[model samples]
Target: MKLRISHETTYGYDQPIRNLVQSLRLTPSIFEGQKTHDWRIEIPGGIRGPGFRDGAGDWVEGWTLRGPAEEVSVRISGHVETRDTAGVLRGHREMIHPLAYLRSTHATAPDKALREAAMSLETTGDHLELAHGLSALIAAAIAFRPGVTETHTTAAEAFALGQGVCQDHAHALITVARLRELPARYVSGYLHSTADGQAHEAAHAWAEIHVGNLGWVGFDAANRCCPDERYVRLGSGLDASDAAPIRGVAMGTGAERLAIRVQVEEMEQ
Candidate 1:
């Protein structure tokens, strides 16, 4: 299947500022189950972009702006071809080691509930089965509540509320898996559902556990299934902050408000 994606981010500030820097992880990566035919990223103003690959081998882009401007806008558009491997991403290649995913920044530390969930995780024989079971548990456990959790919400908080968006769900799942000594990574991307159907909050996130034979296998705890062709993987890291599609700081007098738009669709070629 062929997919087309368009994403736009706009920041409106009350006053003009001097400097701004942002890290962007908006480019899709090539894995075992998916292939990248073409992709690109664009910035309108004083922004520079390429591809930023972290120490963990996750590819992203860091942007910086230094000028007397109040508002900034960034756009990313691309197209790719994908296929479903029955949720099995066999031969998936990752440059970084699995243990690399365990390390987390101060902002993404797991909370009490997340720690408890981690302690409760008993290793089943099959990793795939464990992932599936966890996915079902999360779907059944949590209700999709908007504005309940912010970008910085911890896994414990999300688990306690039992209601969160994709970011929260992915964080909870990762904490649980990490406690069991499993190497799990955070995935950021776009989910292409029918426009007339229920709308998505914005961007999407999922979890991928590293299996010995399979390498990296993706599981969508929010949707309770593995990633399919409708899911276009952009980048991945240890937590949501690490893999955020757009993150940056700008120098301004008042404050800056950001608006984001993402549209993903299936296209016939």
Candidate 2:
């Protein structure tokens, strides 16, 4: 399948910002499951810095805006061809060891409740089955509600609430997987839509676990399935903040507001 993605982010400030620097991980992963056709990142009036593929095999690009500026806009447009690999990440080069992901970050730190939930699960020593079970458990435990949680919500908090969006599910799954001693990390990406080809918002998140022989396999608890051709992986990290598509700081003491719009659609081949 072929997909076209358009993502735009705008920030407005109460007072002019003196300087702004941003790091973007917006490029898609180069792997057997997907191939990039045309991709571009645009920031009007901003200076583009050198971009490189990081240790994790994701492209990292920098941009700077020096100004008494009140607004900043970042836009990304791209096309990719994807194939379904049953969520198995293959042919992607990275230097980090799988064990590095076993260490939990703040967002995925397991609490007493989370630990108990992981310990109580039934497993027959089959890693694959256990991984699937964990995904299913999370999906059943948390009800998908968009406005119930924020970006800063922790896995433990979301688990206790029993409701959240895809980010919550991904974080919770990462927490539980680590509790079981399985290496897991957060995945940031875009999902096309439902199986019936219905239109929906595209930005999405999921968890990837390392099994003994299978490297990293994706599991999206919120969607109750592994990633398929509909998924376009951008990057992976310890948590949402680490894996954020865009991270930056504005040098100013002014209040700021942000607005984002994203669209993903299938293109005729």
Best candidate, lDDT: 2
Clashing pairs in 2: none
Per-residue alpha-carbon lDDT of model 1 for 1-269, expressed as tens digits? Answer: 78778888888888887888887777777666566665767666666756656655557677888778788888887787877775565554456778887775554477676666556646567876676666666677677777888878777777888999888878878877776667888888877762235655467888888766776778887887788877778778788877777777787787888898888777887
> Which lDDT values do the candidates have, in the order given?
0.74, 0.93
Model 1 TM-score, all chains together: 0.88
The TM-scores, one per candidate, come to: 0.88, 0.98
Q: Deviation in angstroms for 190 in model 2?
A: 0.8
Residue 4's lDDT in candidate 2: 97
Model 1, runs deviating above 4 Å? 47-52, 89-93, 104-112, 119-124, 194-201
Please identify model 2 stretches exceeding 4 Å from their true place.
none
